[model samples]
Target chain A: MNEQRRDVLDLLAEGKITATEADQLITALERDQPPVASSSDTRPRGRAKYLRVMVDTLDDGESGQINVRVPLQLLRAGVRLAAVLPPQVLERANAGLSKSGLPIDLTQLKPDELEALVEHLDELVVDVDQPDAKVRVFCE
Target chain B: MPQLVTVRVTRVNRRPVRIWVPVLPVVLVLAPVLVLAVLAAAAACRVYRISVARALGSGWRVISALPGTQLDIGLGRSAVLVTIR
Candidate 1:
């Protein structure tokens, strides 16, 4: 199978595209020779993995939590976003919190800690078929 | 029994990791900027470490109704664990 066809098939497998949409993709792939645009460095091709995040509002006081199923590429995106801000915000945010008598140290967090605490996220891809497994995000 | 509450879900964009090393000389040289820089770096780092690579690409709609205040998110045939709080 050609690269475009392979990508279309992969999207089909991921349940990202409908039967009609998949047909359109396949048709387009065949017609476009020499590839009008390279899939790489342009935009990723294929059905995106999905992550379901929810905030529950309950009488038991459980509404601030989020649960998500993330792809590795999305995880990388999340990491990249998290890295955009400087490191001291954590300390400053925590410092303010501490001043208010909350005992938490944001400066003491590791990469994994940040992942666990983040409320938002994104994704990336490596190959057409060899995508990584899903990541589970749970708020404790 | 605790009833299921309303849940909010927001999609975040991909970001890069930011690091700020506060050396004594630099800190002494730049106090206020150093603090701001540190804050910026930390925020960037947090964004970078987010678990995106392995996450689902599309944004998800939160279903507030679920089993006992807890959410049993469907991941295909399998389910993932989600706490209400």
Candidate 2:
């Protein structure tokens, strides 16, 4: 038996969860996973190395250029943690941001929407070269 | 403080490179300003908390019911950033 399937049965045997809950968990796990990735295949697969944000900057007066790489994983974990924030805190945060005349409101930002945005962020490439400075922000 | 951040020393030039920018010394130099800013922000939070309390204050109470509340945010490799509350 598959490990998750077996684990569910074991939980039922130990009286840890109700049968209904076990069924739902098993169903969700089985249904939600990607069918292609889970299938048995000999093809080599490439895993994502990093969630990368690279910013290359240059200032005319500076001795050397500066390159900044922001790990995407940090952003990912932050979003996951934000999911646990209390609704009251989020509401208050929205009010506080509004008071500062900022358009950002955390309360209205949903996890799914944020996830979609993050996925799109991987495609962003920003490049600018000006007389004073050259700035770039992109995902690698 | 050191000037340039040294990584594993791969490529000296070209490609996207990650360099760490330390903000502690600058923050320390401006500590007094930061403290005043914090005080002002705290006062604002208190006012907001009170106004929010008048409506549905249960959340603040719930947070306070616990011994204490502390929020920490840190940035590092792989993890990038973390916030613990």
Candidate 3:
């Protein structure tokens, strides 16, 4: 164990702090540590494995959760598949998305370019907390 | 539950988006499934609706009305997940 961890344990053994306090300290220490790339990701290096979005809701003492894991490969294939669609279809799709307040233009997306973009977005995570719910979006 | 919705925003995109995909026909292909569910409900089959509503909660219901059941499928740049409890 590291010195910091040992210290926490020692304090616990001496009854200077409760188990819960020791646990909280250890958790805070872990949270403060810098992140290191680990083999646990199990994905091919430099390629995103999944796009994940999670939502947790708590209302009136009831709780619910959502977990979504979208494969990057599926997205890659979907992009390529877009080529088979007629141009008008793509145009109309973009128009419809804009009307829905999500103005995305697929025509400008090239697979390679999108791959590079995804590489950058792999580190992106967005979280929202409402009175009774939490939503998170990210890639892994 | 807190009566007032306290909104907290945290943007933590630690990973870069490596790919983006379009989902067009997925909608059309999925449409028939909904139509069938609707027809089943219209046919006086409360099984589908009851299960779905219960899952979404008495306030929450979902597919087949299975309680505490969840189904999540992710494809391309999008994902669809549903749960009922």
Candidate 4:
């Protein structure tokens, strides 16, 4: 019924596009439409406050567990601290991080970038399950 | 609004130990010393050509954001937990 759908149909009727191509274009348009919210789901959404990491491992019949919750504000402060750090210190920290397989550059961190990173982190969830170990990282 | 931190430690064959640390009282007690330290840090930052105000702001932010953090670790029969609230 939309203009795009009508145009696709017109192309099909004029033999410019095959029926299969018209159908594909309509399906693609449908896929691109925004999702409609359901009336039954109306929970209020709040900004995430903490980043949590949990690990549980079993080795040689012994079990160990670790849980850590880090405030997102702390992470923001840390980035601010990086801004005040000496250039040499940032360089050394970056070198050490790179040596440890993390190639992050602290000198390039900005408040805006940190905000974007936190926003993305709010939707991130990682889970790793093994026969004897489990690891989870998420935000809440 | 967090004003305290509770730490609990338990060991095998030993009773668990719990301690509650009041943050406000500690901060009040150390206020004078903290002021002097900050002044000295500011002087040092001037010598190093760093921004004293920004450094102090970041430090305060880090301290203020410490509340609501939690850590828990357990191994075998020993466990430790720390919560800020």
How well is each residue in A26-127 modelled by candidate 3, as lDDT tens digits? 999889877866765644557556677787777566666667665555454455445444466778999999999998997877767876665567768899
Who wins the TM-score comparison? 4
lDDT of 3 by residue, B1-85 (tens): 1111121222234332332222234446789896786666445424323343322232112112223233453333234444333
In order, the Cα lDDT scores of the candidates are 0.48, 0.53, 0.58, 0.88
Sort the candidates on DockQ, descending order: 4, 2, 1, 3
After superposition, the stretches of candidate 2 with alpha carbons farther than 4 Å from their true spots are: A1-60, A63-66, A95-101, B1-85
**Per-residue alpha-carbon lDDT of model 4 for A1-140, expressed as tens digits?**
78988999999999999989999999999898878677435435677899999999998898999999999988877777777888888899999999999999987877688767876786789999999999999999
| Candidate closest to the true structure, highest DockQ | 4
Compared with the true structure, what per-residue lDDT tens digits does model 1 show for residues A1-140?
Answer: 77888888899999999889999988887787665676454656444444444433232332333344444344544554444434565667788998999978756656676665342333422222212323343322
Q: Candidate 2 chain A: minimum summed lDDT over ten consecutive residues — where?
A: A47-56
Winner by TM-score between candidate 2 and candidate 1:
2
Query: Whose lDDT is higher: candidate 1's or candidate 3's?
Result: 3
Q: Please give, for residues B1-85, the per-residue lDDT of candidate 1 as tens digits.
A: 1132334322334232223333345547898996786567556545756333322221111111112233444323233443332
- What candidate 1 gets wrong by more than 4 Å, as runs, is A1-51, A55-75, A96-102, A112-140, B1-85
Q: List the residue pairs that clash in candidate 4.
A: none
Clashing pairs in 2: A51-A72
Off by over 4 Å in 3: A1-47, A59-62, B1-85
